[model samples]
Target: MKHIAKVVELVESKKDDYIALANDIWSLAEMRYAEFESAERHASAIEAAGFTVTRGVAGMPTAFMAQAGRGGPVIGFLGEYDALAGLNQESGATACRPAADAANGNGHGCGHHLLGTASHLAAVVARDYFAAHGIEATVRFYGCPAEEAAAGKTFMARAGLFDDLDVALCWHPSVANSVFMNATLANVQAYFRFHGKASHAALAPHLGRSALDAAELMNIGVNYLREHMPDQARVHFAYINSGGISTNVVPAHAETLYTIRARTSPEAIDLFERVKQIAEGAALMTGTRVEMVFDKACSNVLHNDTLDAVLDRNMHAIGGMNVTANEVAFATEIQKTINPDDLANASRHFAAALRDPRPIIPEILPYRPDVERPVTGSTDVGDVSWAAPTTQCLTACYAWGTGFHSWQMVSQGKLSLAHKGMLLAAKTLAATGIDLVGQPATLRAAREELHRKRGLKPYQCPIPGDVTPPPARAAGTPAARASQDVIA
Candidate 1:
């Protein structure tokens, strides 16, 4: 506990530096696989703090790893800096307004700016603690990129980057603070491209097969599959390409990107195969050739109770964030822009946990060992969880009712309240890392829990062996244009 106090003090002392770094990242607002500047800043900061930095790991140019300490248990912390597309917003604004220069630019709507900074700060603190106390332990900080669209960690796991770690720690910015004990969905993403001959639609329609028709039919078939699949399974598609702009011209090429998610990896793979069959059927019906190009995939997270207990203990010891009245007023202003339905839903969801209605949550949520709420979303961290005894916690970095991937989140990303929450998370994570390193039994117990939960099956990369990471796209290119366009 004394060590934890010292770690907290160290983080507090360097608060301004971390805050400035977070704000700089928030301004960059780089997209997936294109976080060159954001990754460089973080790597430079960690390297300056005495951690050896390795850039471009796992075939991703933006991904990197920073490490300190040379001996005992190798404790790793995951950091993400990728921002969402089309969410550009002015900082600290209460109203819906785009960035002054770019109306539809990328933005850190997911609070990854704060997320990466907190984890990096935690790693820095852990590194310093090990040095000052002459303790033998390894501290690693992973600069994971493209978590928003691509499962970056899935590729990293396939490369065996996490094989030597004793335990992994992660945290996310959210509306509340609590350890994540729930399991996330396993998911697979792919682009289905169809090929056909183009012809004049009005003059010689029969001379050409419509690839756009194939895409439409494929979507219809997949939509019908909703009834046959498991209740928890989810299937979504986006029209990446609509063939051509002219209605009179029969389009020769078209593509649709699909994402399939389920409660487990096997289930998701099964559903993905069924979806592929539907695509084939659509191609047959339209007299077009279809090609399935795999993009990325990730496994479901294997939650470790031992690690969760450690995180929860540290969170309770650190206490809640100290939100000021001015910060509360700012949060109230941001809350006004949130949808009424979202506000109502959040209110009902946190009714038992919250004592009163407040825009900014200022309390640490109690950890529930029995709670197993299924997070419908997918994360690259799921793969890391499968590879190691990994666990993540969430801290309040946004207004209570603000939804993710929105202007409200981006607006509050650089505010003082967000900085406070980030520092709290850093302290909590550092404390947890220290505890794990001090007690090797705890790490063993976590590994045992992971093994028991995983059974006799070894960790398998969901993405096929032949499937490599997609190449990074040029700046200013739309995501659709960046995706692979396979024609059969």
Candidate 2:
């Protein structure tokens, strides 16, 4: 609170440069782990702000951590720099434009480019605030990579990289402006590879054991399992490999990638184990040997009442950024593109965030603190929340009702409106960090809340014991070529 004005001024001073950073990330449009240029850009900014950089944290080449200040109750500002596949589009306009000759190239459909810059600005501003005022709390900026596949944070949590942090901060680029209260599903990703001998289908069909049959049977089992599971439990799968290209051959090798999610980590783990049983049974039914490897997993967040209270205070200070009449009309047009079911969900979500007479277009979002149930979606920040008393906010970085992982998101990430929202986030987060660092009681309360929830047990990784990252299953498989076929 002491140097908040100066801190805000610092962020303002870097405002144009910050927006440029967001645009640079948007233009780069790198995919998952391949975010080399984006990583360097963010790391360089933190370095310029007088933070020491720790490159390649959590055994990831692109992932790094930057630290400033010098004491406990270390605050972390998380950033993600991954883009979605096949979402490439030029800035502005409703029409589609790929970055190059390729039709379905990488693009920032999730607005992670904004995600990285907003939180980075928060961290840098906080550091500058401390430097100007002689504060004693340490601040960390995490340059997390590959959030698209959920790879980065899980490994960071596994490596105990976040254990020392007292609190973590994260935010996503979204259509609405608000602090979400609901918890996310605990998720686990794995691949079920079925192995068997191959033979000519036309000549010695009886001698051949088709692994494809096992994979198909596994999928059917999961589908049937849906009826028996709780309404909240989610089971999803994709046939990543289905044996030979030829129809005449009895395929010897096949695989199915699977993801299982549930309301809590324990519930998610129980469900994942049950799914493994189904996989084994399917393999037995098809005379194939089953081997499974988990790709990555994330635990559900245990929300902190203390952190949320401070976040709400800050959210009220920085009032919402209003959308123009033309933007509202644009949002209406985008709303039309959504399916009725998705449109209903988005309307319900946005309506809850706004308390106006006729949906006032959500400039400053209200913070909701009392959500008991979990949302269907999952996030790696969910893992960070379990590690420390973490709070995340959603800003209006995209148009209302704009779809995630679509051309709409990629188009709007490069818009002027998104630029405004990014600046608001930078200022708010920087002030919040200064509040915690300069004053000790709030941090104490936040830490107490974390300990109270965790008790004697430590923060646990939600992924099953054997689960691995999914990138290996499709490694060197050229998903870019596959994306081309989809768009073609």
Please, what are the lDDT tens digits per residue for candidate 1 over residues 1-488?
67778988899999899999998898888888889999999999999999999999998899999999999999999999988887889898888788887523888999999999999999999988889999999999999998987888999999989988999999888888788755688998888989988999999999999999999999999989999998678999988889989999999999888999998899999999999899999999989999888888899888888998889998889889888889988888888888789876664343135646588877888777775464547888999988899988888888898887888999999988888889989999999999889988889989889889889467899998877776676544534333343444
* Best model number under TM-score: 1
lDDT of each: 0.86, 0.75
In candidate 1, what residue range of length 10 has the lowest lDDT sum? Answer: 478-487
Q: Give the backbone clash total of model 2.
A: 7
Candidate 1: residue pairs that collide: none
Candidate 2 collision pairs: 294-467, 294-468, 295-468, 295-469, 320-363, 320-364, 321-363
What TM-score does each of the candidates earn? 0.96, 0.91
Instruction: Give stretches of model 2 more than 4 Å off.
Output: 1-4, 97-104, 329-333, 350-360, 371-374, 464-488
**Residue 259 shift from truth in candidate 1, angstroms:** 0.7
Report residue 203 deviation for candidate 2 (angstroms).
Answer: 1.7
The best candidate by lDDT is: 1
